[model samples]
Target: MSEKQEPSIWQGFKAFLMRGNVVDLAVAVVIGAAFTNIVNAVVKGIINPLVGAVGTQNLDHYSSCLSSSCEGDQGIQLMWGSVLGATLSFVITAAVVYFLMVLPMAKYLARLEARRKDQEKGTEATPEVIEVTELEVLKEIRNALVAQRGSGHDER
Candidate 1:
């Protein structure tokens, strides 16, 4: 009669918030936002002109109409290059994080978790109980044969 019930919606939400991964994700997101600012500056100040010289950089600023009424209008566009640069920066940052941080961390954590689970299961084969390596067994046999020959000559 005292069985535990499934968690309520709010309780589930609280549990989600308390999870280690959720907290880690929040931190990573904050750092990533800050990182984006740095990357944007690097691209705009350093990389953009280099890339622009290669003709791969988007130089197309803005679409404009040349109608008589619009002759005096200038489509001011420092924003587009910054926007494009920011997009490239974001992609590069995301790739670096995925490869360097998230993927390797996930793999290492999984390996450690698997080892913990194996230890908990207590089904791991005992190293002492297992047959010795082939090299060790061969070395022991060789030593025994050598001893036999040496003893045979001594007995004679």
Candidate 2:
């Protein structure tokens, strides 16, 4: 048999776009963007200062460009302190979710499943069925014929 033809670029692109995974990813992206502002605010509000006390530095005011020309080909320099603050906030959020949501949810689901299994296991098992063999049936038929002959049942 001949190999199937490949889908065209447009067809493939459409298929990719139409898949549920892609749609879910798109929705997650939108939600993430909306949530980012709140997360950033919390970091800026609380975590940065806490870190600042330990390092004797602040995350709020962290970047300064060193290029002599203010606008030549230089992009915005990276601010490590702000990055650190963001990272710290992310860690905190991750920890909270793990402890408060994911861990507890997992444990609860596991316990529920275990309980269901236990209930099922406690019930009695079904009885085994026996299958008769052709030889056994033939033996019984022969015995019945012998007994009928002994009882004088020769109607034929």
Native-to-model Cα distance after best TM-score fit, residue 103 in candidate 2, in Å? 6.5
In model 1, the clashing pairs are none
Write one digit per residue (lDDT tens) for candidate 2, span 31-135.
789876766666566656666687844465666666554354575665677987677667877765466655665555445545555679995433333343446
TM-score of each: 0.39, 0.42
Residue 138, candidate 1: alpha-carbon lDDT:
45
- As a TM-score, model 2 comes out at 0.42
Task: Give candidate 1's error at residue 116 in angstroms.
Answer: 22
What are the lDDT figures for the candidates, one per model?
0.62, 0.63
Segments of candidate 2 deviating more than 4 angstroms: 1-3, 59-156
Candidate 2 local lDDT, residue 6: 96
RMSD of each: 20.7, 23.4
Best by lDDT: 2
